[model samples]
Target: MKNLVELDKNHFIHPTSSIQQQQEYGPKIIVEKGDGIFLTDKEGNVFIDAMSSLWNVNVGHGRKELAEVAKQQMEKLAFSSAFSTFSHEPAILLAEKIASIAPEGLNAIFFTSGGSESNDTAIKIARHYWRIQGDTQKKKIVALKRGYHGVAAASTSATGIPEFWSMAGRLMEHVVHAETHYMKGTQIAIQSLREIIEQEGPENIAAFIVEPVQGAGGVIVPSEDYLIEARKVCNEYDILMIVDEVITGFGRTGKMFGIEHFNLQPDMITFAKGITSGYIQLGGVIISDHIHEVLKEKSKGTLFHGYTYSGHPVATAVGLKNLEIIEREGLVENARVMGNRLLKGFQKLQEEIDIVGDVRGLGLLGAIEFVQDRSNHQRFAPELQVAVKVIEALHQRGIICRPVTYEGVDIICFAPPLIINQYQVDTILERLQDAILDVRKQLG
Candidate 1:
């Protein structure tokens, strides 16, 4: 294992990581096992997975049913192409089950490997639909300024994080980014849609994509009427509204899908992360029948877009079992109850901690922004790395949380597994409180 670590240090390259840190330190924490909401590291340390292992793992870890289903499906049909007319039972049934649970109008499903692929697939579908209707000029994808899609070409272009662009070199063309919801109040945020559409000319815009609750953008929850109003604007301008539910889907927001919270059905919904509880790589874009029918009538040939594992039988089968486990265990209701508990705890922390500012959340998705002066809502110097220090402290105390540094603000976010109990929530809150106190003392 020591030799293996040295080998990994010499050869392995990680995504979204500091390569220098990895090469020098040789992997900070080597995770060995996960059971429920706890992860066991190589040194026998157990840590609460507060971020649900990257905002997935809704059914928690060590789900034997998922493994059993994957085994059975692999024995039956290990690999198959979803290209052309080829199909499988797991793929077909999972799509039907997803349609039943998805928002009212979204009934069609196109599977992918994960969130980035799902988002990029949605972008392609939007452009193709417009082209099929003889509007080849309508190809622009407008996303909110701070919204995060994924790291793929089209997804990264649609992402509003500037740091991603700094490293990703040139992005795809005709992708327009609009003002974020945080730039102004709800009314102005909604109006920014119209402003962007007008400025860019609606005829050139094919779709407007956004996260129902901006997760990577510091869990920015929009106003109650934001999505409803945005839907109206899209309808007014003949633009398709694409909702990225990658983090907010599958009971992350106390509902099956985040769009349900707003009472709006989107033209296309890109989802991942929680679908298979991180047991397998699975994601998809659910399109509305209206859009599907339009393509049926207007399109001439094959859609000309698919993945090697678009609808892998094993992944879909594991997804079926994962969804079943979620339903049987009532994890969604647990997320609602436990999320309320977490939010109330953070609110109390805001009262006790001077740096804690603006605790916000829905269901298991929550975050606490750190500020230099809470009263003034002033951010700490980026060099201070306040959020990073707090999260590292939490890690030492056997808790895991994500540090979000975007747009000059620092935040520590939480998205614990839906199966987390009240006692576990208390443990996480207490550890977090201690970590914050420690950070404050060090700062002073």
Candidate 2:
């Protein structure tokens, strides 16, 4: 253990982590193995993976089928670039399968390595599509404040989280942010977007990107008509709508995609995370037939964008098998059932706990916002790091969750795997209750 800690401290670089803490303590837990919704660390202590390990891992872990498919694909033809007509069966079949399950009219798929790449690609393609249509000036992007896209350059620029932008440094200048759904309500959010569009002049805007449910920004589920109204506003301005479903795709939302819950058609959708259920890296952008047809007709030559691992054979194979497992096991329906149980549990906690201010969830994604005074919805002092403290308490009790601070409020999020069972749900609630109790005592 000491050797491994030394190795990690000396050589490894973690993402979105505290470097000072890592240098002082190495890792919080060195995960050795995972099965279903539980993870075992190197020290043999088991934990409930309540956050689904970054809100991916929809199928849980230790799935032999995904491993077998990956092995077979690797043995058959590990990798061959899909650049310029070169292709593989896994890539082609996976694309077809994704199209069949994706929202209607989003028939075209462009493979990417992961969510960040998918987001970056979506930004580029949106501008490229407008360029092809002879609107070269329509290159700006509009995103929602408190929405998280990815950590890549363009995507990071689109992120409404101020801290991410500060750390990323020198973000793209074309991106602008609008009010989030939590600003007032969906109606106010829609109006704010329209105001931003008017201020920026729609002629300069290429696309408006949003997460159907903002994941990292506190699992914020907006009003049902939020996206619908926003889509109408975009349509009114000729701005393409892009949905980032990296965390809400697959079965996390209990509907394969979060957008399906809204029943709105987006011009482009960026997906990852659950496509292969973390078995392998795979993500892509599904464009509507309109964008595809425009590109097909007007592109001069050479798209001038792609990744070495794009259309990777093993990754696509794993994705195909992962989708198969999700369907055959009825995991999506399970997510809906289990998610309701979790949401109800949070609501119950809110009723009992003084600090639990807001409990919001949909499908398997949920969050419990903590506050100083529930009556006035006063946030705890930031210096106290209340959410982080609660998360530490939860972690000590053999549960893993994430702390989300957005809009100057702290929240603890839950996004268990879609395969979670009733028993596990109950266990999660029991443990979480105890953890909150511990924090409350400390606070008092």
Candidate 3:
């Protein structure tokens, strides 16, 4: 274990991690195995995977069924490119299954390797769709503030978080962000979208991309009518709507897809993560029938955009088995039921703990924000590192979660595996309460 830690520190440059921290502390935890909702480290310490390991793993972990399917598919036909009319059965069947379950009129699928590539593909498709129709002016993409797409070049530019921009100097051009999270009582956010459209000259805008419920941006669930109004605005200006479901798709939010919560029919839906329960790498963009028709009718010789692993056979096979497990076990419904318990637990914590401020959740995705004064909702000083400290305490208490301190908000986020049971939910809440209390006492 020591040698493994030393090797990791010397050779591994982890994604989305601080290099300095890794050098100083090695790895946070050397996870050795996962089963159901629990992960065991090399040191034999057990932990509840509360964040689903980056908001994926909807079907939990250690599923031999997915492994068997991947093995069988690889042995038979490891890989075959989907480009140039060369196709395979796994890709075809997976695409068909996804289309059948997807919202109405979204029947076309374009496979990619993962979330970032999927989102980048969707953005390119939106631009290509407009270009094919001689709307060459429609090149700009508008995303919502606090919305997370991916880390690819185009996806990063479309992402609304500022910290992501600093990773690589000068993100892609022609992407802008508008206000978001305005509830039913306020139309400021929607109005902001309209204003951007008007200022940018709707003709210059290709698509308006957003997440149904912001995940990394603190699980911010917008008002019920927020997306409905945004959809109307997009329709009014002829701007295509793209929903980034990378984190919210495949039962993460209780529903099959997060857009289902708002009854939205977007022009494009980018998805990944839970499709295969993180058992294998797979993702794709689902396009509405209208957009498919446009592409079919207008696209000339080679589409000229695709990834080497666009339609991996083994990955798609694993995805099919993963989806089968989700349906057979009814994990979506389980997520809904457990989500209610989790939210209630959050409410209980908020009521009992003075530092616990706002609690918000949608399906299994939830967050608890910390405040210095509950009466005025004043935040603790940044130096206090309240969210980080609480998360560390939870880790010590055998729970895994995430901390969101972006834009002056101190929030602890949770998205446990959809297969989690009532007892597990209660356990998470109990430990979380203890962790928060521990942090409070330390602060005092």
Clashes of each: 0, 0, 0
Q: Write the per-residue lDDT of candidate 2 for residues 203-244, one digit (tens) a residue.
A: 999999999899999989999999999999999999999999
Off by over 4 Å in 1: none
Alpha carbon lDDT of each predicted model: 0.91, 0.92, 0.92
lDDT (0-100) at residue 200 of candidate 3? 91
List, residue by residue over 222-285, the lDDT tens digit for candidate 1.
8898889899999999999999999999999899988888998899999989999999999999
Off by over 4 Å in 3: 182-186
Off by over 4 Å in 2: none
Clash pairs, model 1 backbone? none
lDDT of 3 at 29: 93
Clashes of 3: 0
